[model samples]
Target: MHAFIVTGASRGLGYALCQTLLDDGYFVVGIARNAGPALEGLAARHPERLLAVNADLSDAGQAAASVRTALQQLPLPECATITLINNAGVVTPIAQAGHYPADEVVKAVAINVTAPLLATDALLSATGGLPARRRVLNISSGAAAKAYPGWSVYCATKAALDHFSRSAAVEQEGAANPARVVALYPGVVDTDMQSSIRGSDEVQFPQKARFDALKADGALSSPADAARKIVDHLVSPDFGRQSVVDIREL
Candidate 1:
């Protein structure tokens, strides 16, 4: 059986990805801060195939442990194919670059950038090498490319992740059994993170217009639909060695 690891699987896109993978008959190891209601429902449906691990990816040690638990649950010997979906991320409250809290920015970098790299390295070590047709998908955001005044930290971290994914793709290219690494931009979705950003005090940040427009235009994609598309790309024959692809283009 093929095995997949999806981080931030409690809700939003991560939860959707886990559910979709389960439907496709793949064993999934889901790591999240807490087992939210949506994930609890999924676990009830696929008790054997789903392994829910609660870990704060921002905590370096916890992040590494989560990957180890996932490996233990789905041994490399038993599953010849493995996929790592670094989907967990955080969007700090909208604040001007100079005014943003240092602690919050640190947490954002730890989870959005450092944790994914650590998790991928742990998986590679545990598996000994890349699996046949292995793939590592980093969930990124359009913010990585575009600049929004109050979202500096969030944008910077995602931009770092995108760069890391591209560089890792090149490193994996020469491996005896290479893996395709792709940084995927999932687009804006109607998620809790959006709500958090929208409800923040705009007077201090003065950049609520973008959030307001997203809500007014109903431009958010459903997590389930986005998750399906992400999975399709991961499993596609032509996934090839491309280092980056925006979901909007797919």
Candidate 2:
């Protein structure tokens, strides 16, 4: 059996991933703050396969601990692989570095950087020896590599996640049941997050026009398209050959 634990699974790419995984007969534990109607429909269709967990990832420690306990308790059958996709993230507080509210800044850090790292540790400890191929996919961004004027917090958090993958991948390599980790950059997909980007205050995000143009020209990839490519890579034989991947490059 293949088990996939996905965050932000209520909608967008995360939801698409859950659907795709279930269609292929895999078990999915979807972690979402507000497990929306779409996920509800998925649960209705695949009752035995999809488990939606309602937990806000902003409280990273609590959410991680909760999922760890839940998975450890479930009667999950033997698995070929157990994959964790850290897809929950916030691209908010879009303003110059010093101008963001303290709370928003802290919240973004928790959701973007802290949550994925904690969940990675939690999954490794909880899954036991059931699956030999354990993999972690941290949803990162190009902002991690190239800085944007108003995306200080977003860029920094993604960079932290990417660096964390580098260190964790090496450490996992030596463990008894090592889990391969990759920090992937899923290019500009037309998710609600992209909508938020387009709606940002232009004075703060000067590059908003580029994203606007991308939308106007139909350049953004759909969530389903991106999710399919991502899942294909996740299950491929050479899945973890690299610690970082950009879907566009694939």
Candidate 3:
């Protein structure tokens, strides 16, 4: 059996991914800040196969601890294949880099970049002895490639994550227990994050208009549908050492 771990599973893409994985018969361990109604419903449906954990991934120690706790929930003689989905992310209120609050920027970096790296490290270390195909999937964004005037912090963090994913993929290739590492752009989904961006003060952040257009044109994909596509890619036998793939291109 295959076991997968997903972060930010309380809502949006993360929650959708959890539901898809459970339906596909994979043992899933989902982490989030709070297990809200959606997650509660998922747990009730898959009591034996789904393990829901609540933790703030923005805290470095808490991020690492979440993975350790999930590892403990796996069946004894742990499954031969393990997948870690670093899907949790944060988009602070839009503002110029200089005007953005220091604490908010730090929190965004922690959740978007630092936490994912730490979580992947902990999972790889813990599963070093397991005889399974190991995989790490980093959820990236288009912001990593393009620059938006008001989203400096978000763009920087995601760009950093994209490069980190490539570097980590290279390292995994040479490891004793090689794991496939792929960073993917999951596309913009209709979620609270989008609303936050759209509702930002247009005076300080002029890009709110673009976000509004995106929302109005129905460019936003459904979280559940995007989640299904992501899980499909993760389990594909032909998924090679691409390292970086944009869902838009696919």
Please identify model 1 stretches exceeding 4 Å from their true place.
36-38, 204-207
lDDT of 3 by residue, 159-194 (tens): 999999899888887888888888899998988898
Top candidate on lDDT is: 3
* Candidate models: Cα lDDT each: 0.84, 0.87, 0.87
Clashes per prediction? 0, 0, 1
Q: Cα RMSD to native, each candidate?
A: 1.7, 1.5, 1.4
Tell me which of candidates 1 and 2 scores higher on TM-score: 2
TM-score of 1: 0.94
Scored against the true structure, residue 115 in model 1 reaches a CA lDDT of: 98
TM-score for each of the candidates:
0.94, 0.95, 0.96
State candidate 2's TM-score.
0.95
Best first by lDDT, ranked: 3, 2, 1
Q: Please, what are the lDDT tens digits per residue for candidate 2 over residues 1-250?
A: 7778899898888888898889888899888877655588998899888887778889977668756854764565677778899999889889997788899999999999988989998888777566457889999999999999999999999999999998999998888888999999989999999999999999999999999999999999999888889888888877788998888898
Check candidate 3 and list the clashing pairs.
80-132
Clashing pairs in 1: none
Q: Per-residue lDDT for 234 in model 3?
A: 89
CA lDDT of 113 in candidate 1? 92
Q: On TM-score, who's better, 1 or 3?
A: 3
